[model samples]
Target: MQTIWAPWRITYILGEKEQGCFLCQKARQVEHDEENFVLCRKTHAFVLMNVYPYNNGHLMIAPYAHVSSLTELHHDQLEDMFRLAQLCESVLTLVMQPEGFNIGINLGKVAGAGVEDHLHLHIVPRWNGDTNYMTTIADTRIIPQQLEETCELLRSGFLLEQKER
Candidate 1:
């Protein structure tokens, strides 16, 4: 497998355990939603806008627990993760109206997980013709929307729906 190692990932790998856990930290700091690009927080997981996305409105839903493998998670955690993923898809569709999405988890380090300490599902909003010559020819992916705007749209949509419930 071809590994793409970025300089920032080193921090995740070498971080102290006393920091508790990164995923848990995000879960705990609920008030930092806007700054953190966190759209919604469910019982077992949360959805956040991807700061660096393959496309606009790209997001990720992850378990609150800091587990590396899917099998290591409890049934409730797995269920909630999928539930959040489903809701994330709905919110993205409602707000961005994308043609489709790329939703799944990269299980391990070799499989392109930037945070190997936690398992998260990437919900990447996609569109027809979104991939262009830039990616193939220029080796670059263009995201048309800002992360803050995407997060605001998703967060408002999610909060509105929550109010309905």
Candidate 2:
């Protein structure tokens, strides 16, 4: 059997899970944006990198409201979320140059929603040959870049894009 060393995962495995919604916590803590990996914030929504990402430039666009369903959001919130999704795609494309993107929302826990209570859209950047045998054979996905480094790149990209707008 081949062993893969993922030393960082131990923090999540052994650390005590904080009470209350993590998304809400992150949303409220605007001062801690860098520590929380928040790339951009809009009037009604924000964009941040996925700590447990499926790919290198994976991002999530979420509203400030802590509603489980999209129906609960006002039209402005929904619009803001979608606009942030576009921003995520643009920033990722500029920084990572992905060939394509997979963008969608998982509504429930059974639907692959990691934070089901707060509806968010995922923007996963893809490239040719990004998926390898390790995914099917070992049931593991490899992310090439460090989360902090990716966050820095994406954050810079977002700033540059927004400034040009």
Writing each residue's lDDT as its tens digit, candidate 1 over 1-165 gives 544344544654796554555566777888887776788877888887766678888788888887899999999999999988778877788888988889888987899988888888898888899999879976867666556666778877787667766
Model 2 lDDT tens row, 49-141: 889999998998889999999999999999999888878888889999999999999999999887779888889999999999999988899
TM-score of each: 0.82, 0.96
Candidate 1 stretches with Cα past 4 Å from truth are 1-22
Candidate 2 accuracy as TM-score:
0.96
lDDT of each: 0.79, 0.90
Candidate 2 — worst ten consecutive residues by lDDT sum?
A: 1-10
